[model samples]
Target: MAVLAAIDIGTNSIHLILVEVDESTGATRQLRKEREMVRLGAGEALKKRRIGRKSFARGVEAIARFAGVAREAHADGIRAVATSAVREALNGREFVEAVRVASGVDVRVISGADEARLIQLGVSRGYPLHGRVACIVDVGGGSTEIIVADAERPRFLRSVRLGSLRLYEEFLAGHDPVDPNDYRRLQRHVERALRPLGRNLREYGYDVVIATSGTALGLAGADAASRGLPAGRVHGYELTAARLRALQRSLLRMTVGQRRRLPGMNPRRADIIVAGAAVLIGVLELLGRTALVVCDRALREGLVAEFLDERLERASQSGDPHAVRTEAVQEYAVRFGAGGEHERTVLSLSLSLFDQTRALHGLGAADREILYAAAMLHDIGYYVAASSHHKHSSYLIRNADLRGWTPGELMIVSAVARYHRRSMPKERHPEFALLSPEARDRVAKLAGILRVADALDARELGVVDAVRATARGGALELEAETAQEIDAELAAVGGKSDLLAAALGMRVTIRALQVERDVDQRAVAGY
Candidate 1:
């Protein structure tokens, strides 16, 4: 047996693991797994495309602490890696040097595809797939890595920028009690982002799916999924999508405070649970798999295996073009300071309204995703020139080298961003006329929702909270829930809702609902 330690510095948190491995039997015993949320990707990480001073300090501090713990455990050698945020940060190298000096642990920043290969090694050692077709999915804070493996080697792999903390802060922040519509919208966004992967998964079918992440652990460990499991079975807990969705819905109904008190809920992950659910459910939907086995073994475990066995290493390089493209697009947006609170809040509102009023528009999940992407990228044109930014946005989006999107889908995202603040969609418009009839309609529908969402956050004053949309007597009723006055938001929505009204053939009415301040979790006994 060999004693070893591993560290993973992720976008959302930092992790350390100490383990003893028996080489002859290929069995491993985990002595300890420690995690702390440094949130290295928060603050300026995403918005400014660099690790902020405060977050950088916290990250270095966390690494030093993890190193100290490994020493206490008498670990032979500690291997560490930084994923997602660090690799993309401008000052990422600076922090890496600090970590080396403070902790004496040299940390390597691995690429998404490389991360997938390591994950495969880690999972195989822990679960032993037995040469069957299996899919290993590791959902990190800023990225999700998926690998399809036969008994010996990987068949295919892909990584996407759909992480729980990133999604939570970007799409559902400040919503104390998340609206059901927003949750559904987040699901659609994930589904859309993974649409290309869905096609690949269909081609290379698998016998089983495996997941490794805090969100998966939290969801699988919940009473709903783990109520009657055997002792020490958390590593291989089989969780059904239906049960996971049920837990997600239940969590959505409760606030952060209420969720923290629930048994099996990780208090550190309470806030980002919804975003994590999005990634899990998205993968499930894409694979057409009903359930996935949870693996407590993760990147850290993979790192240990790598140190002990060089034969475990596979895959060509650390990066994939598609994964890199996703990062580039996000970085391009932040370069213009386009991904502020206003853009994110508007995206949530747009998605909420689109989902709730689906009956009126007759749009499906794919169309809903277009709305979300548009909401995220709509304001990016302002980076070019403030005047007529909507037109410029259309041009910039169309010109960007986006990956994992078909030509038609890219055009749809471009069209939606274009029409977000401009004249109504018309057959005479040059770009609008290029799409097929169905695609054109989708663009119009998504753009209409985006208009209303943009209006709700007009001037970047987010007074609106939850929104519910329903059709009544040739009028669309949109009820908003907030503690602050929404006079400006309402006034802005009036002008912006014109396109929405025209698209749905109904006038829009904006009203307020009194915010619910309390979640009576008295029935929920604390753990």
Candidate 2:
């Protein structure tokens, strides 16, 4: 037997679960569970994209205490993962480093996609999904992850930015008793965001819907109390859409203080419960499902299951390490009508430039990979509209269901692709501004290189065969090997080299050199 502790660092709270796993049977027995409402993503922190001093302190203290508890329990191992709050924050790495110093545990900030995957894993452990197609919905403090799956594997996974705390802050925070106008606006926002999710759920078609997370459990408890049922164990409780709508209406009519006094209500969750209810009701209505089953297991429990699975050497159906990231990216690009000779040429040039300018850019292999993805997808926005295609590219990248990428990585790629053509990275752009200082710099550098590479193939005739970069005294020179004259490409480079010059802190000059080549080796190698 092995003892383990799993901590879920969430937007609204930090949760700890201690369990003892039997190696022989691969079964786990829960030892203890703890929750602290640190509200890491509360108020202006979410809007400003930074963790506040007070919240950061509270979060660190909570994790330290929890780590101490795990140590006291003689845990053999500890696994901690952070969700939307830390994942989206500009100072999220700062918070993670602080927690590590305070608790001696490294926190992994999971992407929305991974969060959804783990939620399904945890829910499946407690509630059997055998032979039944199920839709799992988890409404957290800062984001919601939805999954459509069967007994064998998940058919779809999606993470939306809407959550109880986020919705409250955005729409209903100021009003004690929700203003009618504010409530309508909130509903509209939720509906609009969930439209695509609704379509996916309809197409996948699930036999049952499952709801997890604190918000769901609290709402389920309240619903049970109202119906004169035992609210002690809410696990596996069936909450109908009609009853949920009624609960939402009643909660909205009451002030926070009044809601806090309700039977089975979690006093700590009173402020955001209404918004949570609205999100659940909207999802249920969208699926056209009459009821959803509440599961108490969520991310923390999922961590425990994963730990045990690793020890037992159990292979997960959906967790294939051999799957190629390029395959997923290529599929997504094709969906957006983005792949062709031009895109291929731009991708080759981008990789070549990134590799050749490594010393100047000071980037590593991981960043080079991000640049590869951004280059392949830079022009996908043309499918939407020719005008302002850069902006459209950013949106498509963010929304695409590309596997094997974290949310932060996707955001960086999106920002890089967005700035490949038009304006440089600035603090005014919300997407660009949301990134951390380090990430912003990375985007700027990668975008700068992308801009130059794209300009080299401006005419799309592939006039430039290859570019060799050499740094001189405070200046960079690019020699392009090609048989044809690249006057048009040279002019385009002149127009677009400003960003690169600023990034490298030097002047950039490019000239085409006449050369003969039997075949383009770089193009043939599929760079």
Model number with the top lDDT: 2
Give one digit per residue, the lDDT tens place, for model 1 in 376-445: 6787766667788888788877877664556667688889998988599888877698998888877877
RMSD to the true structure for each prediction, in A, is 23.5, 24.8
lDDT of 2 at 349: 73
Show pairs that collide, candidate 2: none
Off by over 4 Å in 2: 314-527
**RMSD of candidate 2 to true structure, Å:** 24.8
* lDDT of candidate 2 at residue 490, scale 0 to 100: 91
- Per-residue lDDT, model 2, residue 26, is 33
Model 1 gets an lDDT of 0.74
Q: lDDT of each structure?
A: 0.74, 0.81
Q: What is the total number of backbone clashes in candidate 1? A: 1
